[model samples]
Target chain A: MADVARLAGVSHQTVSRVVNGHPNVREETVLRVRRAIEELGYHRNSTARALVTRRTNVLGVIAFDTTLFGPAQTLSGIERAAREAGYFLSMVSLDDVSPDGIVAAAEYLVQQSVEGCVAIAPQRSLVDALAALPGPHPLVAVEGGEGSGLPVVCVDQVQGAHDAVRHLLELGHTTVHHIEGDPLWLESEARVVGWRRALEEAGAPAPEPLQGDWSPRSGYALGRSLVARRAEGERVTAIFVGNDQMAIGVLRALHEAGLRVPGDVSVVGFDDVPEAEFLTPSLTTVFQDFAQVGKESLALLLGEIGTERNGSPGPSATERRVVPARLRVRGSSGPPPP
Target chain B: MADVARLAGVSHQTVSRVVNGHPNVREETVLRVRRAIEELGYHRNSTARALVTRRTNVLGVIAFDTTLFGPAQTLSGIERAAREAGYFLSMVSLDDVSPDGIVAAAEYLVQQSVEGCVAIAPQRSLVDALAALPGPHPLVAVEGGEGSGLPVVCVDQVQGAHDAVRHLLELGHTTVHHIEGDPLWLESEARVVGWRRALEEAGAPAPEPLQGDWSPRSGYALGRSLVARRAEGERVTAIFVGNDQMAIGVLRALHEAGLRVPGDVSVVGFDDVPEAEFLTPSLTTVFQDFAQVGKESLALLLGEIGTERNGSPGPSATERRVVPARLRVRGSSGPPPP
Candidate 1:
């Protein structure tokens, strides 16, 4: 520490602050200290630190369906946040999304001596399981929404869903049809609620909801059914989809059916995933700040753990944060065909 | 064990074998025993087992960019394999894929008391770093090819790439353009090698490859440049993209340019991801056995670790296993334009 301090013309306390990832340090000074530390091959030995503090210096993450775009992005965010907080992240994934699955995974992570855990799977049943688990460590939920009795950080899926459906309704279309996400996820249910809410307020009949498993294939299949209905001369002018992948499916189905998006059928999707905008006509979708959700999830967990490394008790009462979703209007959606 | 046997109407040994995930057990018997265990809330206490056997019953995995389809599937594979072997899996993802980064990640895992570790990142430098790290724990590599002084298991990228290019060449194309993946991945370099080799054998020109960072955007960008070259009346007939995500990108760009796929251009992609079949013109891709890779990774690591849990030392002379890759013919690629 002293060697790095002398090399960077900084005091020992400043070097400690930089190494500990203190946010108050000036950016340029942090860079200078980092350079000196790198040149000196100075690494804050986590093992030695663990011995002194009696804490593992490891944080645990419980995520599910990591192959999906949203969960994958959130997991990445949690990892970045943990690293920046000077903690190593250890993760355990559930092959099954059942409550028992969460319980088993939590038990495993808890046994590994994780100082804190961030549960990243957002199904209601999983949240219930998380709430029921006896934890010796602080736990936080991302995308799990509120009412789990644990601190939660999430993008408001309900509002995001509402914005998407309302966009279609406001496009002068009498009714907006929706294809929702997996039933296992609370996000899916929340989206359904938002879609129904928008329709109820507009005095438009909320058509019997269709279910999708969050795959592009499901969207395509469901879109094919809707196309069949359109072939029968039904008024299906506008649609809102649960997520981008399924929307892609719907787009492909509509394309194959010889219908033009936003012309034959105006469409809106959720989670403006990176590929969403680059789709042939591009996508008009809701964008959730998943990265912020992840960062806040970890920060909340650390606060619960009450570590001096990330400063004093994280938020004595800062239990939940709801990140707002933004809508990106792209070429895929517009006024209903005259 | 005795109680479970009595409850399930099976012998004590049968109950033990089933609990341990022995492959020899009959399917029906396995189900019966599992039901009894679940109904009775029987859980294998890993901590107690660790104390009795001096093994942590825990394994470590080091991966990178798991959000990508290939790595994410492999990580899930490893998790499944580990659980089936009655071991808990702890994974640490490297935000950066480099020799130093991998070394640090490995050191962290080693300190966490992992009995064995699976190195899942596929960068050559990472392999080199793994070879250099001192470790008391056993180690194995997946998607990492030979000569790393450690056991390596991987899909034969060279063969896969060669097959993809050869398929294009045999279609009577004069030359094939390649969009390679990230330079940091060994898979990218191997694919490049295979493309060049196939072109050499066919006595055809292999254009200097364009690079992609395995995103749809990069693929779309590279695809647009090709579109421009085609507009200038250059032969841009066949392209072999690095992965399906990029292929989608190229497909979008080409579609926008009014190029008739298979009539004016033929494209082949790697990693037959789930969405490949549903793309506007379905994608033809190389399918690597990531599940096998994951299973063998853990099996090999356990063999190196040498315990009663997973049987013998995997390969006393553990070298490498090259899982074969298959080419899936879909709608995207066809005979080149006359």
Candidate 2:
């Protein structure tokens, strides 16, 4: 510290202030001090410095541990944004959502003195747990409920699902069958609502929906059930799948049953993942910009840390950022054949 | 420190020894000190403790950023193993592999005081960078290598590729075409070797290999080239695709060319990804046990940290740990039509 202070012609206290990222330092003086530190190869040992200023420059992230399209892309986006903003992201997975288990995970980060937390809130259990805790540190939520006095960045799940269902209805299908995610997930519940709303607005009978656990095998099982019903002379000309993986399984089941896509049934899916384009018939699905959600969530957390505000313009401003999804048309969707 | 000392009925110096993870303490004394710290929720605020101990309990990882099957699976496996072993995994992606770029990516982790690093050394440039660095930290290279010295944990890429080709030969294919990854990768070079060795051992002429960038589009382009050659009266009895994504593209291409698999040309792919089973004709491919590799890597690192030894077991040990690959025979492969 003394070497740097002497080299830059600054006092030891001034050097400390510059190194600790104190906002009050003059830009020119901070620049000179940084140059000296770099020249001296003086690594600012974050552990030692954190003791005096109590800021670790570490941002804790709670994310789902899956290779599924949405969460994985969101995590990548968060890493990019967080690194650019000069924060190190330390993550814990919420693959298991028991309150005690989640609490244990959060406690581990809290013990590490994380400056702020950003929970990738995909499930209701996670949201409920975060809501229960009066977090000792600043907190933000991603894909979570708005107006908990905690900032939330979310994709417009209901709107995206509505867009997909509306696309199916516009193709002249009298009714559409739905395969929805586990009801425990907020996205799944919201998507079901969107499908029902689109059907009600069209004055069409709401067919009973098939439930899936978001795995391809689950989708295959439900698809097999649907195929059996079709074999018994029931007609389902269009199906809206909850996600791309399930849509893929449905396509395979229909193919094996001698039904040609678009000619026998039109299929629409959500989360137009990379593989959807490569599927034999191709997939017409809704594309959610998961990377955008990740980027915005990171920006929100940094905004909160710097100014103690969750990136809101004001209380009157929108507390929620709902990124919209776009519908991508491909070979799987078409007007009812003949 | 004072609170912990009072709770443990010891002086501050003893508490310091416990916090530093010194192995000199008696077992009973260590237990007493740990219990006191847990009761007080005292983790020594790693930032503060790191100043003196110089250990961060964090392992930095640099991997390719693609959502491709191999990298994604390896990352997931590493994350699982890391969390189980009480280490934090901080990852950065290298989108390109220029030597300087690889060094910069690694320097980011070095600056964070990661006690060790695991570089996914795939390309020649990355391997060169890894070799050049004067490491003050332990490094375990995973998945690729130029030369073996610094504790490498890798599956037998050449052997995996050989097994795929041998399986096709056993199924009575007189010749098999090869599709390979980018030429820059060590695995690609090794796969080429394995494929050639299989043909030479059988005294069959080496078929010309097709180039791909480990993507479905690249495979589709190469598949089209093969279809054109087939149309010119050249026969392709079988093909060994570099990965399953490319195999899917080749299967689609064959269908479009009116060539039925097995009846026209059998296909074998590497990396039996989740989607392989769901493809129109389920893919027969090579499967690497990434979980075993990940678990082994974590165990190796922990052993290095706990004791001074690297992956080489003590003198008493008779065998080295290596994760092996297996051939999964599925619907896509069969005997060539007579």
Candidate 3:
């Protein structure tokens, strides 16, 4: 530190300010200190600095099932947002979603002295586990549905599903059948609610929704069952799948059954996955701004952290942030069996 | 420590050993200490412990483009392995792939006093930047190709590509066109090498490869272009696409051009994503065991860290570990049109 200060011809405090990214440091002085530090290869020891300043500038992010597209995209969004906010992330991804696992992950982060935590809690169990934790650390949940009394940032899953159903109904379909995602997920439950509500509002019959474990194979299986029902004289004119991956399977099942999409059955999916646009019959689906969800979660977490640091009462526990879901209509949805 | 010792009827050192997970502690003693600690809701301060024992129990992971399937899966695998190994990950995902960005991420991890780092450096620039870092910190590269003298763990991309092409040639394709992934990636380069080599060995002409940015849209666009070449009297009987997402697009393109998969065109892809099997004509693709790659990278990194701690010379810089890729033969690839 002394060598960098001397080389930069700056005072010790000025060098510290520049290194710490203090806003008061002049551009020229910051440049000089940075150049000197680079030339000396002087990397600041964050551990020692953290001890002195009591600020680690590190945030914890607990995620689950990151191999899935939604969780994975949300995590990537959070990483980008954390970096842009000048905070590093200490990430813990739980392969198994259990109460003990959630508590253990939170405890681990607390031990690391992370300023706050953001959990991608999409399942009710995960949200409950996080809400039950006894700690002073600030926490913000992403896609954690209501009633846990924790601040949350989520895409409006119900609204997204409702829109898809409404679009299919307006296309002259009397009713829209749904292939629900894993029943354990809060997202699946919410989408089911939306689909049911839309059907009720339209005075249309609501058939029992088929359950899927959010896999393409499950979708394919359930889709084949729907095809059989159609073969048995049931009206299976339109289908709303829980996610795009499952939707792909549904498309395949319908194709194998010689059912032309929109020509015989209108298919809709959620998650507007990248390949949605190029499917055999381009999919009409819901788009969740996963990155926006991430950004909003970080902003909420930072707010809580700031309140804690300032010794001020934070926002209400029920604070909710909803990133709106958009419906992207394409070739898969059209007039039903004209 | 004193409180836990008193409650557990054990010495402070016994409690310490139990808390630190040290061996040699009696099972009864460990259980007693744990119960006491749980009863008191005791949580160890990792920062202080790190300062005293100089063991942070944290490993740094610098990743890039994690929104993509390959990187995302690899990261998930690494995360699972790290937890099993009892280490927390300080992850930095770079949105931009540049030398300066890589160096900055490395420096950031160093500041956190991470014991070692595993960089998911699949790009040439990333490996170069990591290799250029002037630090004593142990580093391992995951998916970083040969050269640059770094301990690397990666799937055998060349062999995977060779297997895909060989399967096509064995099925009686005269020549197979290629749709390579983003050119800057080492995986893309290596796959192209394997594809070319297989064609060369089979005494087939090597047509120019189309470059796609690993997006389904790019695959759709390139697939249409291939369709055009076929219209112009080119033998576009088979195509080896870079990834499954792109393969989906190509299938749609072929279908639109009245070309039936396996009947008029056979397609193969890499990465064997979960959706591959559920695609219209279940995609024949290469399956990279990302979990194994993650486990191997962590093992290699831990070996380096252990060597550094023991003051022993570490393994050779060019030490390489390759996980074999399996060719999943599905319905998509078959004999070319007669």
Top candidate on DockQ is 3
Best by TM-score: 3
Q: Residue by residue across A42-124, what tens digits does model 1's lDDT show?
A: 75644444545667767888888787878888888888788788777767788788778888888777766678899886788
State each model's CA lDDT, in order. 0.83, 0.78, 0.91
| Clash tally, candidates in order | 1, 1, 0
DockQ of each: 0.23, 0.42, 0.76
- Stretches of candidate 3 exceeding 4 Å from the true structure: A1-40, A313-316, B1-18, B21-40, B313-315
Candidate 2 chain A, run of 10 with poorest lDDT: A309-318
- Model 1 segments beyond 4 Å from truth? A1-54, A307-318, B1-54, B307-318
Pick by TM-score: 1 or 2, better one: 2
TM-score of each: 0.81, 0.88, 0.93
Pairs that collide in candidate 1 are: B303-B314
Using alpha carbons, what is the TM-score of model 1? 0.81
Task: Mark the 10 consecutive residues where model 2 chain B has the least summed lDDT.
Answer: B311-320
Q: Model 3 clash pairs? A: none
Query: In DockQ, how does model 3 score against the reference complex?
Result: 0.76
